[model samples]
Target: MQLTQFTDLGLRVVMYLAAAAPDSSPSTKRVAEQLQLSYAHTTKVVARLSELGVVTTRRGRGGGLTITELGRGASVGWLTRQLEGDGEVVACEGDKPCPLREGCSLRGALRRAQESFYAALDSVTVADLTRAPTRTVLLDLTRPAV
Candidate 1:
């Protein structure tokens, strides 16, 4: 199953923040520019993250965004599940019934596979994604502009 761009950006935002210097908080605009995401989209994602208690946002001068310790420890699988919800992977839900709905095991199979996907992701945390080479790369991206 493929992750939506929203989920992708959410993960990137957390990783960027995790890699940032301990005392530095990055602005939403900076996060957007560094990630090449639209400012509005970044704003929405950051807002959601803030609401979820994964990140904190401060307003006005000397204010910016920072990932919480919870954010750093957040499981990728849990985040994906929250972001993706229980949306069907197939077109099985509607007023009209699918022809194979009665006897097909496709939906069940897909569900199991999706569970496996999430289980794998569950083993990984935002901090896990920022190790070594990835940490270096994310740090570069989050670096304050000269």
Candidate 2:
């Protein structure tokens, strides 16, 4: 299944925050400007992420947005399962099953493939997005109790 632009942008925003220093907090505007997303949309995504406990947002001076510990565990596969699940694919979400459901092997095949696709994504985490020194340093910085 193809990822919607919404999920894509959401992941990107998280990645940008993850890439920065732990104490480094960037505002939604900064993230939007850097990523070329509209402030409104980015704000919405950030809000949603905040609601989901994926990120933390703070107001006032020296306050901005930061990726939450849960954000690291938000794997690509988990994202796909959440956003691009069986229902996200319209053909599967319909009240009535597809006419070819019984006779078609394609549907089952596609279902299995989709599951596999998301399973692969699940293996990757925000940590996986970073390379070598950055990842190690960042991981240490974002350690659990902090």
What is the number of backbone collisions in each predicted candidate, taken in the order shown? 0, 2
Task: Please list the C-alpha lDDT of all candidates, in the order they appear.
Answer: 0.89, 0.74
Error of 1 at 31 (Å): 0.2
Q: TM-score of every model?
A: 0.94, 0.76
TM-score of 2: 0.76
- lDDT of candidate 2 at residue 100, scale 0 to 100: 69
* lDDT for model 1: 0.89
Q: What is the C-alpha lDDT profile of model 1 across 1-146, one tens digit per residue?
A: 88888888888888899999989988999999998998998998898889888899999899999999999999999988887778877878698779999899999999999999999999999899999989889988977889
Error of 1 at 24 (Å): 1.2
Any runs in candidate 2 off by more than 4 Å, and if so which?
A: 85-102, 132-146
Alpha-carbon error at 56 in model 2, in Å? 0.8
How do the residues 1-146 of candidate 2 rate in per-residue lDDT, one tens digit apiece?
A: 67777778888777777877777788888788777899998998888788778889999998899998888667867755554434523364368867766676776677788778888888898767766765665445444333
